[model samples]
Target: MTDQTPRLEAYQSKRSRTAVWLALGVAVITAGLVGGLLLIPRADRAEPIAVPTAFASPSAAETPAARATEAATRKVTLPAKLLSQPRLTDATLQKLADSMTLQFKDTAPETEDAVSGFYGNLAKQKLTMVIAIDAPVGNPASWASGMTHGLKTSLNAGPFHDVNPGPLGGSAKCADAKASGITIAVCLWADQETYGVLGFYYRTSASVTSDFVKARAAVELPTP
Candidate 1:
């Protein structure tokens, strides 16, 4: 029982210092392992798995269908004299053409390379106005149908009937329309490259079909 309190206190201090030294040694070992792992080369490390995503193909313009469309497309042209009528002189046709062009501009703002001409005798009250628009038409039949319907609506016309497209081989329709209390023979034609409308004043569709064919031939200069 000699100095038992001091001996007990000394033993406790020694245990506490030993525990702290052991904890510090473990901490240093863990830090060294972590540093070693960080020093490993990135190339040797396992790559992250890549998640697959939806793949998009090329655009329509680059496809075969687009090339075929390009091949099928052609350009059209219009001449000064759209007909061989003797009475419809160049000067008279030019004046009428200018007027029709103005009217066309007002109505069809989206038309491109548009041309218009007038034929027949105005004095006889028998005249025809030909309007041709040069552009790419994918479906000629559909275009003709739509144009015919539009013309009928604009002119307050009656039902249109199918007409022979002649040797041009596209689509055509004729309707009898009334404008200013006068009957008008309205015809529309569409091809791959162009579309046109004809207004034959004081005439019948049967009488103007041939004229329409001729006018179409004159105006539509297909690319060779």
Candidate 2:
């Protein structure tokens, strides 16, 4: 039993030191594993970003080509009486139509049918002429310009300006010109299938846009 207490104390101290070192080794290994996990790329765990989409514009229904195609399918004819005037006899109308045919022969070679008439008394007379023609006009603006040019050169008319195209939706123009010593309002309208000319004797272009619109509605028979 000699010196047994020192030996027991020394052995207990050694065991305590070994336990402390084991705890430190476990903490270091855990820290290294956590650092390695943090170093991995974040893209694999993050949600994907969303992309945006675009839409297209709508198509128009009242384009010029559409209108022309619709107009080509309809019939064009003038009524027996227009602008509240008595219906002229067929012979008289035919004679006027013949004269128009001759007048427009070179100017409008596409003319297929013609109708002509006079309304009101001599003091306030008006003349209306319409021609149904074969026009394959794709652009209404250019066709209107060319028609105005023909009027200027063939009829010796002045510069023409645009007017209200009316509910029918084509092209209309008017000009003031001297014809037979009278200041006349000359109006012209052209659509896909018809060409019309109106002369308001002793009147100004400023005063006859409404009359031209009315006469156009009367003479051009559009299908429902």
Candidate 3:
């Protein structure tokens, strides 16, 4: 019993100090939890991101390969029988020469029909004409259409007018509006029995259709 009271007092003080530390730790943990909850984001504050589609608009210019492919794939309808079957004759050649002189005012149109498949100077305003006689017959309209279409395609040009020449309205024609580089104002006149082609170059200022009409007016073809 000599120091029992002092020992009891010391133990009670130690218990009080431990209780104070425990309460301080509980307060700190509660404050940390509240702070974390306030810092969390809400759904209303967020922005939406836009998603784009895969395909885009095409460019203005087309590729060269595409143009070439388009040209290669183009269709041209030709007659069942070709107009090139006719042979050049001396009588027809004479008629052609007379027509060139009378209509075109080109009297000295040298007939290279035997070698060049045409008459007149190719260097000047020449005519590649042939009368289809004693050969297999074909559609005149179809031949004219094919000829113009071929010219338009090969030359990569336009203004080729489809015409029907002759007073009887039995022939077909295709003439250009004007003449240009490799783009002569040519007119092809084709009837059931005969067909002819007239080409104009830089040397002549005459319309191909006009020349053909004049030549037809001048010459009289024998009935087949």
Candidate 4:
């Protein structure tokens, strides 16, 4: 009778141990799920990442397959319209170019008065452009379309949008060389590798936009 009693007690103890193990497993799985939820990306924002200088050069750090996949995730990086650089006068523009380490990459195509252009770095995989136009653009909307086309042709992402003129205000109105007017666009894009390019509207024709893009595509920029 005593031996039978001992065996019955042992069986109950083993069953309790099994229940404890099952509870522990459930807790671990629950913790893992909670961690996964925290790591998930937000819906509204793409992660801003470092992009390679593909638009400026022929090389990249990512694998070819990775580069191709990343290119698909890209979005518009620049504003559809120009941003007012309040003090973007000839003097101010000079300082801005100096700030970006301007180096003449090509001569402005639409000008004959020793028209030169510059290219420099604004941020990682992003570039700033400077083209000496013959005169400032009077009709921004018309010029913007040309710029959008130029960027689409130059960048891997072909589609672009321009911001409405009413919202940006009149001081931000179409370029006027005589009024010390200067129009600038800071374009950016999304993807695994982020990239940005800048376009400046001077007294030059819309054709200069494509020329500047092509020149900057092969030029070097300042280091951040």
Candidate 5:
């Protein structure tokens, strides 16, 4: 019989060629996958980013309410009571009123309009001067606070404590006035401004006009 080694060698060569072709196919597939990844669109491949815009600036002094409040606050005058005896003249009282930082009532009688209170002049240990306030049945604290600020400008506070909020008003009486040492209290009826002097004043006890002096009475207050 023949050795047959030559036939076996030819068969092994064919098998080696087949294995090389398979290896080449795998290499081609890997290369294609890498090329596809590189060719992908930037929009689809990249992370997203946000852009910012420029804003317009606001105008200066654009607040109207703050301006109105600033304008609304102004200088106001308050009235004071004068002595009945020893006859304090209009000129004398006017000078004192001017010096004491007082403003009289607009519709007050001519007698009261001119006569302001004296600081410390007394004949019989009784009060000779007092600041009159027109506090109605409502509150007069805002008015009082305003008055206190005004008074502090000229006079100084003393003893003889009064209610923090001069007084409360709920009556029908048209007008009421009170005067103590220097501060006066009053209360009247409500006409217009249902909550008249409501927002303006804080509740306070003041020594208002003591008309029926024999008694430390709770006098009726008038409306604004």
Candidate 6:
């Protein structure tokens, strides 16, 4: 028989071509799938970001409720037993109140509470003051955190201690703060019921804090 090797070779060559075409088709399909994946929208897969905006700030004006609250806070005075003998003079008290009011003008509106307290002479023309706040009946620490939020200068926190009239959770103190450049010292305390602040003043921040520590016993703290 005439050799059929040539026929067989031709058939094998045809099979190779068919195999090549099948492989190419698979590659093309895979490439199309990759291209489709690349074209898919990605925006939906990304997380949305949050942005905060403030429309209007609170007014500096003290509302009638705020004013009444301040009055009540002041009246929640330290008991005579706690008050130092030779109690604060009406004039000195007024001056302290006026000084605190000035501080309040710069700060009161920042807080969600009312302000009250009185001051007396620590020395000639120097003042040691106590200012009480009528804060909500919870979280002294939250109230303390914002003590100097909008103040002219930053406050440095000092040691935390218990108050004499000992508000429920006691009190924490911060000093070396300024309001419109005047030196001030502050303590935040709770009477186990409400929270209040004590402030001391001097010509400079250093002196005011030192005096604040010394005068803590003199100031009348609030009761629950």
- Tell me the whole-model lDDT of each prediction, alpha carbons only: 0.59, 0.54, 0.36, 0.30, 0.27, 0.39
Q: Estimate each model's TM-score.
A: 0.58, 0.57, 0.36, 0.23, 0.25, 0.39
Q: Which candidate model has the greater lDDT, 4 or 6? A: 6
Query: What is the TM-score of candidate 4?
Result: 0.23
lDDT of 6 by residue, 83-171 (tens): 24233445434444555445543443222333344444333334344554443333334434333331212333343333333223344
lDDT of 5 by residue, 1-224 (tens): 35787777776575455334323422332232223323333332212222233332343332322332333222112223222323233344435444322333442111112222333222232323323322121122232233233222322223222222223332111111121222222222221111111100111223332332311122222323
Error of 2 at 201 (Å): 1.7
Best by lDDT: 1
Candidate number with greatest TM-score: 1
Which 10 successive residues of model 1 have the least lDDT summed? 25-34
Candidates in descending TM-score order: 1, 2, 6, 3, 5, 4
Question: In model 6, what is the error at residue 28, expressed in angstroms?
Answer: 75
Query: Model 3 TM-score?
Result: 0.36
Question: What lDDT tens digits, residue by residue, belong to model 3 across residues 47-153?
Answer: 22222434433443433323323333221111222222222233444444344323312211111111112344322334333222111113445544544554454
Model 3: colliding residue pairs: none
- Residue 44 CA displacement from its true place in model 1, Å: 58
Clashes per candidate, residues 3 or more apart or on different chains: 0, 0, 0, 9, 33, 5
lDDT for 188 (candidate 6): 47
* Pairs with backbone N, CA or C atoms under 3 Å apart (clashes), candidate 2: none
